[model samples]
Target: MRVRPELRHLFAAAFGLLVGSAASACGTDAVGIDACREIESARCEATQACGATEAEAMHCIDLYRDQCLHGLQSGQEPGADATARCVEAVHAVAACARAGAATMADCPAEPLVAAADPAAITPCVVIARKPEQLADCAFVAKPADTGTTTPSGNDAGDAAME
Candidate 1:
């Protein structure tokens, strides 16, 4: 499926905060601290599950973990607000994954490519936190403009129950 250019950039960049640029498979809102921890744990767990065959997912998340967290808390960077928002978005994505709604494997080939659609490789990027049980994951993976150009917003809060 062809992803819209602007949405692609927005989605990719948000996910990029974790996995790399849109180039790699990689969020919005503020979730609780528990949700943040759960997001990280869930991502690592799913990536690990892909195992040896999916080294890309595991390595990418592992490589970016520290930097991603640091980016949020770095005084020289975005600061605590950004950190909270980022952590929240991360929690939303991780929550989606744990529910078996998405994974790193959803990313297409050449995931690290900046132009790649995060919607494809990381369904977590677009997955809704509303907890719908529809048979099709279309709504889950569908990209909705959350009025957030940055990696922070109420997207996670609106979509997710947390």
Candidate 2:
């Protein structure tokens, strides 16, 4: 049976919308650029409470927006939920501890490439008192395996073969 051309187009459009909506529902979209600044500001305040000079705090916060924008563009930053969690973690810090430059244990780490390349560092790193304290952001362990390697199927099969 031939599908009407218009109906085919309509079906494609509907499928696209469904896929997009599903992704949105699953929170796959990264946090917006504004989140970068918000996290930076909160971190700066915490640091300032600890003893950071106003100038130092301001400079640190200033770097976050542009750097975060860069990270987001680079696709190396955390998603919206991760960023939000980081923000909350920062906010939860005791004023004195934050002032003392305590590690933010809950915040996501800067991506490895960003860590090695200053230009790619995420906004989160901008607020880090010690960037190293933050772990590397989770990334795929390695590029997709492109080599051809048939699975042995099961441990029993491998044992029998051996």
Candidate 3:
């Protein structure tokens, strides 16, 4: 899934803030051993703020976080790494979109389709890495806690606004 253009700035800003406060990309707390927790937190928070559904928010968390941690260096991460991750995450989302995946909301409106074609989706993903372009899951794993429901917001129309 692709985040709306306006939301990308918000997501990046959130990432910056998380990095600033956390002081370390991977804080070795009592949580899981994953080193990219902070990045995942920032991405998911931004996704929620930008009006992504819980599922979409989780999807963004998984993709970007995995991309960040995958073959990552040990210390403060580089933006280039994230940018590359965004591209990869977007590709996963694009494949899902092309496969007619289910979505919580309508995808972005292109010329005549719900969202940009798979070819265009990558560039679009390159633009907004938040990943909410599809209505359903292609490669993204479902959230573990589906029975619990947080109060939803107006994220249902978030993609269409793009």
RMSD of each: 20.0, 17.3, 19.5
Residue 148 in candidate 2, Cα distance off native in Å: 29
TM-score versus the correct structure, for each prediction: 0.27, 0.37, 0.25
Task: Write candidate 3's Cα lDDT for 1-162 as tens digits.
Answer: 999988999999999998888887565432221424443444354444334567876776666555543422323333545444533443444343444534322233322123324444332231134233332211121222543222211122234312
Query: What is the Cα-based lDDT of residue 101 in candidate 2?
Result: 26
lDDT of 1 by residue, 1-162 (tens): 999999999998887675654434333232233333333333443343222224554454454454344222111233445334444444454545555545434422212223233544454443223211111112112233652122322122222221
Question: What lDDT does model 1 reach?
Answer: 0.36
Q: Go through the candidates in order and give each one's C-alpha lDDT.
A: 0.36, 0.44, 0.39
Deviation in angstroms for 62 in model 2?
2.1
TM-score of 3: 0.25
Which residue segments of model 3 deviate by more than 4 Å? 1-35, 71-162
Off by over 4 Å in 1: 1-76, 103-116, 123-162
In candidate 3, the residue pairs with backbone N, CA or C atoms under 3 Å apart (3 or more residues apart, or in different chains) clash, namely: 1-131, 1-132, 1-133, 2-132, 2-133, 102-135, 102-136, 103-135, 103-136
Q: Give candidate 1's TM-score.
A: 0.27
Candidate 2 lDDT (Cα, whole model)? 0.44
Among these predictions, the greatest TM-score belongs to 2
